[model samples]
Target chain A: MLGRIEQKVLRGGRLTPEEALALFETDDIHLLGRLADTAAERRSRGRAYFVQNRHINHTNLCLNRCRFCAFSRSKGERGAFELSTEEVLERLEGSPEGLSELHMVGGLHPEWPFEHYLELLRAVKERFPRLGIKAFTAVEVDHFSRISGLSLRETLARLKESGLDLMPGGGAEIFSEGVRKRLCPEKITAERWLEVHRTAHELGIRTNATMLYGHIESYADRVDHMIRLRRLQDDTGGFQAFIPLSYHPFNTEIRGGRPSGIDDLRTIAVSRLVLDNFDHIKAYWVMLGEKLTQVALLFGADDIDGTVVEEKITHAAGALTSEGLTREALIGLIRGAGKVPVERDAFYRELNLYGDRYEDRQGDGAEAPDRFRTARARQ
Target chain B: MRKRLHPEGVVTFVVDRNINYTNVCINRCRFCAYYRGPDSPEAFVLGRDELFRKIEETLEEGGTQILLQGGLHPGLDLSFYLEMLRSIKERFDINIHGFSPPEIHYIAGRANLTVGETLQSLRDAGLDSIPGGGAEILSDRVRQVLSPRKIRSAEWLEVMEEAHRLGMRTTATMMFGSVEGPEDIVEHLDALRGLQDRTGGFTAFIPWSFQPKNTELGETVQDRPLGAGGAEYLRIVAVSRLYLDNFPNIQASWVTQGIKMAQVALRFGANDFGSTMIEENVVRAAGVSYRASRRGIVDAIRSAGFKPAQRDTHYNIIRRL
Candidate 1:
């Protein structure tokens, strides 16, 4: 069964939902990873992408207290926080060195009007004009539409006009309604999330899609979610990346354990094979940790999703990785996985390419000995 | 190589539970998540009742042996281990494969005895075999960084050699994907192969990946810890099978890798599915939990196109499933 899927994937053919599920169930993990690697290579060659970005979760005071969310907090909750426009600028100003992108997402604040989000985006853009702002999710966009008394298109258009360069992929936890009801019933539905992204794409705003796995969602649910995103990409061609968010079970209402490494890699590999229309697949290092992110490179993830200077959402849910990674550390991770590191902006355009000689020429004393290189040399 | 080594077309596994006798350890290795400081509220040395209950459950589940291992408790001496072992042997007719090299080394030091004396005493007191738990990577360069408080590479090898010399066969293990280089891995394999060449005491070689979820090492090497992927695991298992010519068996660590990866490892030169692990706390403390029943393991092996057999501690098959 997996053989047929492998042949199809090798021939640059799209995988059926059934085929994708079969790949998920197959014990031939090496083959699945190899096929995903091949597909990723076809898209991005040997280049692995990361953005020098900072994550500013503007507020944690949320209206929709999703069950799976550990980041969201109710009004006046103990840890609830809402960053002012000045504070957001101060945070961005703290790290301007090689910072090309600002990844801003937060909860749907119950009291904050839609103008507050627009103003925050404008203020951030005015302060750091060079930094591309990839802000908000489809769920957030839907919330803005409801809060602003405007249509979805108008809400996205207003935000885009106020300097939102791209949209992040969150809140699309799992598209399966049965699971989504259990996970985030108060949050936007699957159709509403996709509609927001579809409307954003139609307005020339490229966005990323995500699926939060290792929760209650089934394999069929994941395949359905990816196919839906693929269909949207086929129509609008504006989906920039696909990130499979591994569910972290820490301070949350839903207290399932974290996903195993095999499940994480399988989701990444299967996403690569299934989402053929999506150009980039990200292994979000904040949730995956540094090591599995490197392995995910082999499993078809091309992007490690930026420096992410203070990732709060996953950390609130019990992520063990550092909040942020340095550029050198990112390069080391990519190169350690035996791939070329391509520093990218939010849109994944290559800002700098660190080839094999880049590290040797730099001669950084802190560099660990490249064991993969040594192992290959020995072979 | 697998075909050459096991022409019988059978994959063997030991149905046993790893009972962590205690969580209190002096040698709190940076890479270890199982050990707790003596003063910690969670620190515990299992009471006799709890230990007996675990053993009784293992026996009820058709487990032929108990992989009894624990942390190097500062307060526990050789007499404590001896008494525990004698009591278990007196009650249950089951093999007690307890005490890794580090624990043995620590117990010997506490009692002011040689490694040979320690192994002989423990063997005499119902320790059926030694498990390979402490040999993370047999390179002092890596060992000094990972486990400076624990025994050095030579001491780990010496303990295993002494156990072998005392006619007690032991298993060999390598916990890769930590801070070690590939040369360190090769060095580890070389040490095991060289020792096996002299004593021929190792019954099997088990190589598992380092789970870096909740350990001090995981936080220290936060950016660049190589939590080795499945391919890296397969490569290591295949290389171990090819390199460790003197060793007879290679175990697929389904506890670390999931069952699918372990099944794939059968073709990658692993002959044994490690253990059922009716209860495993060490790896779970590191935030990875993979459970498999005897029937689940048997079905996995069968689906992977190999016959499954239940084996005792000495690699002797007791039943073919």
Candidate 2:
């Protein structure tokens, strides 16, 4: 299977997660290189993209006790807290500038009514009619449905009505239950996690997928993770990007988990080579820091995720990729990484392409030409 | 020349935070985009009050160690470090993982004290450990071209040796893919191995790429035949594993390289995935960005076929997540 996949990948074909996993173990680095290059080319066939978004985690107070989580506070912990809908709205109001998207995701709050979340979404959508609402993870969706005593279909319907445009790929922590049990036991089963994202896709909403690495799993487990995500993406076709998250072993329930940095970069490159289906591989600017993310572009990642006006989850987990980054900073990082910077919409749509699209004023006084003049940005 | 990674599997004792004690530094190293000139408004040689506050915050965040890394200021000396270390131990009673090779060498030169005496003084004043900073491509050609005033490779490794002889263990780092070639990388690893072969006081060897952003190095990324790709990243890991044959552990550089490439570096030969940095402004300021938490890194390693264990500055396994 690995050999066949390598051949196909060399011929510019897609490999399944199973194939990717098998290929990961292959000693043929050249063959693997061909497969990765093919996948990258395929992923970039259309216009490359980036997003201008603000990450507003509604609440840090979570009901489910995921052991690997350092961010979540038990309902009664000193720092445990949830934001009111007005507070969430106020955060959104701070982001009405150039941002066209508000990314909201948080722990499964113990007692926020389903309608309360919808109100949060509805308020932001109503307030900024143009800004797309990319809120919640599949875990939150399942939680809201169970709490509201409504099936997921009805829950999603209500959310869609409340102006939920898409979902950010958090809480799909790992796809394997064996690993998930050890890391984050109470969040959701691996299968159920995929189910929530899959169901969201059925409702015509696109979502991202994520993998948390460098903790307690094996290489085979990583392969298993990519395979699971690829299989699900193949079935649902909803996953737009695959974000491979790095683990920091600080201020968490577990005693120790200091992974090597090189291993982190290797996982990302392998993910790109292996996950043949996912379009964008994001070097999320939050966890790995800005410099590493810039270098990540050469390895296999194309998309450097947005300037998160605010981020709580990674911060809660003792990482600094939280808070905001201006578009100029984002473009600067991307340009420094030596790639053409293209501003993207919420759902992976190109908004504006900068650098070289318009010549420097010293060279050409003419106005910049709209490269994709008819490009319709999908929110 | 078999490769090695200094002292392997030593760091895993307690929590550590990268306290860029002061962004203010006097040196203008070409590759360093993170530092601010000493006179700049943004420049800040963290006051005793600010350092104590930062240390208190790190302790509150469950950190046991602080990496107090900055630049080689021209005027600061042995007294400067003695006071900083003394103040920290005086106030917090936490571990002081401060300074690096160049700073030590510079202080030794300024104080007219031997490297051994300087480290001895710092250790006496409660300096616990040293981060391997100013190690941007450990070749003299790269060193002179990058930062002419900064101590050369021999001086940098000499300080580590003197500290090791004086009963202080420190971490070693390699800043590769800047100006030096692969052979230069071998030089850095070899120097580390030679020192570890004798003193055996080096804790771990960390190699990160040069982030060229807002730096004196300017906007010049190499268009080499085989650039800093996954293959090159893996080679560094594998070679570090092989060349530093006596050094048992090679860390995956998630700071210079992203998490995925860091993972692949595991295959080449890396046993550790650095820190779950609470706050890393230096690398981010240079522009490589990706953020991962305790859960994310653990899951990544688990998924990649290893038990994610958090370690201390000495590489002692603290928690097996």
Global Cα lDDT for candidate 1: 0.85
TM-score of chain B of each: 0.98, 0.89
lDDT of 1 by residue, B1-321 (tens): 887989988999988888988999988889888888999999998999999999999999999999998888889998999999999999999998888999999999999999899888889989988888899999999988999998999999999999888889899999998888899999999999999999999999999988887898888655454356655777899999999988999999988876656876787799999889999899989988666778878877885668999999999999998
Distance (Å) between predicted and true CA of B189, model 2?
Answer: 16
Model 2 RMSD vs true structure: 8.8
CAPRI quality of model 2: incorrect
- Which lDDT tens digits does candidate 2 get at residues B114-180? 8888888888999888878787767888888888877888888888888888878888887776668
Give per-residue CA lDDT, model 2, range A1-379, as digits (tens).
7667757766766666666566556654445544554566566642335677888777788888777777788788888878888887777776646687788888888778888888887788888887878888888998999999999888988999889988888887767778888887777788888888888899998888888876787778888888788888879888888888888667777655555544555566778876767778987878776655665665577787887877777777767443766665666566555567778777766767765522232233222434433347543
Cα RMSD for candidates in order:
7.0, 8.8
Docking quality class, candidate 1: incorrect
lDDT per residue for candidate 1 within A187-291, as digits (tens), equals: 889898888988998898888888999878888999999999889889999888999998876688986445656678889999999999988999998877665
CA deviation > 4 Å runs, candidate 2: A1-5, A14-18, A26-34, A45-48, A256-259, A320-322, A357-379, B1-321
Cα error, candidate 2, residue B91 (Å): 26
